[model samples]
Target: MLHNKVEEVKSREDLIKFLLHLRKDLQTKGNAWENITLKDYLEAMEAWVEDMDGYYLNTNQPIPKQPSWKTIADILYAATMYE
Candidate 1:
């Protein structure tokens, strides 16, 4: 399932996982962590679903903008589905 690779997102663990990834990226690339706040991830997830090609094909149908954390969780989850 796409959601499985998102790690244990219990009690905001999702956000923590995101932060840890951000930290690692910083340490490796020496670039400041991109501000992937909950709001930003929500927007990115909407974009990912509406367009981007991953394991699933999201319809081009338009959906209301929302800041649901699952929006991104689903995208990250879906990407690893086929891996």
Candidate 2:
């Protein structure tokens, strides 16, 4: 799942791979994606980042203390379809 892929992001190369995967996913499943427009995608990204710590705490995951490639990738990947 994409969640797994997002969790696996730890380096620049991984971020690049995740982005490529997102492109591929969009090409294959764009109909099912919610944030198709740039505006929606950016908004979702902002909202998701703002609430990311709460999500981690709620899910019993360690909250990221600093923004890293993984966190950035997670935000981008989530914004692709997150409501």
Candidate 3:
């Protein structure tokens, strides 16, 4: 089930849609927001850094001097999901 959901994210647009769905799910389920803390916010930033590192290692691409706003938004959404 998880794999299928993951497989659906074939592009950045799909990912944004999925994250929006996840955000809605989290909201409807309740307490997801309540459970988040300052630490969680920091952890989300850490997750972004880790993700960037992994991307660099796996793709052999240098980090962009200026990451796109969409990329930053995606990272923040992912971090929130972790919380």
Candidate 4:
């Protein structure tokens, strides 16, 4: 999946480009390019937290709670598309 590639990205610019490409790919799959709202961003963050919790509970090893600086930059770049 594209998400797998995304997780492996270490460079900020590369991650931003990948995320933008991902959005376009989704659009090709019938996902609209509507403005992503704050609610949408929050929901995504919440889902990530839940995923981390589940992984921790199953493996007994905590997944990294803090994303890398590059990842945070990527998130901010993605947020620019929001309404």
Candidate 5:
């Protein structure tokens, strides 16, 4: 059910780096997240979840199409941690 491809990460460091940037992006955006556009939302979500590519990152599971409404809500829930 993994959404992401089977491509192995280049290294754990990369994963760590990706997560750091993701956290930073969310942190900087802060309350400004609401003003972001759909395209920006996609980009932010992708980067946060390792560029999801074709799947959701949280569970590393493939989504039927993009993601569900709950999915977005969950993302925001977790993302709020950056605040």
Candidate 6:
């Protein structure tokens, strides 16, 4: 379900929908999420961006040189719970 949402994010509107899905997920399963507060989410986002290349390398995916809609959505979705 979440994977489908990630793949569906092609436009700004789709990005917004994915964000809403994140919100809903957090509301329903926040205890499982790492970053719940706004401060935590912001800090996690910064850290994630700093180490994004490592993430790609570890995942065996090519590093993205440009920011696409999916990349933006991935960052936002990760920031919600990424440690």
The runs of at least 3 residues in candidate 4 whose Cα sits more than 4 Å from the true structure, single-residue gaps closed, are 31-42, 56-62, 69-83
Evaluate all candidate structures by whole-model CA lDDT and list the values in order: 0.47, 0.86, 0.57, 0.54, 0.45, 0.85
TM-score of each: 0.32, 0.89, 0.42, 0.48, 0.29, 0.85
Q: What is residue 72's positional error in candidate 1, in angstroms? A: 6.8
In candidate 3, residue 63 scores what lDDT? 71
- Ten consecutive residues with minimal summed lDDT in candidate 5? 1-10
Compare the candidates by lDDT and give the number of the best one. Answer: 2
Q: Report model 3's TM-score to 2 decimal places.
A: 0.42
- Candidate 1 versus truth, CA RMSD in Å, comes to 8.2
Better of 3 and 5 by TM-score: 3
lDDT of 5 by residue, 10-78 (tens): 355544544455456666765655425556565565564554433354567665365544444444333
Using TM-score, give the best candidate's number: 2
RMSD of each: 8.2, 1.2, 5.4, 6.0, 11.5, 1.5
Name the 10 consecutive residues with the lowest summed lDDT in model 3: 1-10
At residue 17, give the lDDT of candidate 2.
90
lDDT tens digits by residue: candidate 4, 1-83 = 45455556678777777777666655674245333555776565555445545644675754556876445543443443333
Candidate 2's C-alpha runs over 4 A off are none
lDDT of 2 by residue, 2-80 (tens): 7688888889999999988888888898888899998999999988988888878898988988889988887888798
Ranking by lDDT: 2, 6, 3, 4, 1, 5
Q: Tell me how many residue pairs clash in candidate 3.
A: 0
2 or 3: which has the higher lDDT?
A: 2
**TM-score, model 2 to reference:** 0.89
Clashes of each: 0, 0, 0, 0, 3, 0
Candidate 2 whole-model C-alpha lDDT, 0 to 1: 0.86
Give the C-alpha miss distance for residue 30 in model 3, angstroms: 6.1
The C-alpha stretches of model 1 lying farther than 4 A from their native spots are: 1-11, 31-64, 71-83
State model 6's lDDT: 0.85
Candidate 5 segments whose C-alpha is farther than 4 A from its true place: 1-9, 32-83
Flag clash pairs in model 5: 2-62, 3-61, 3-62
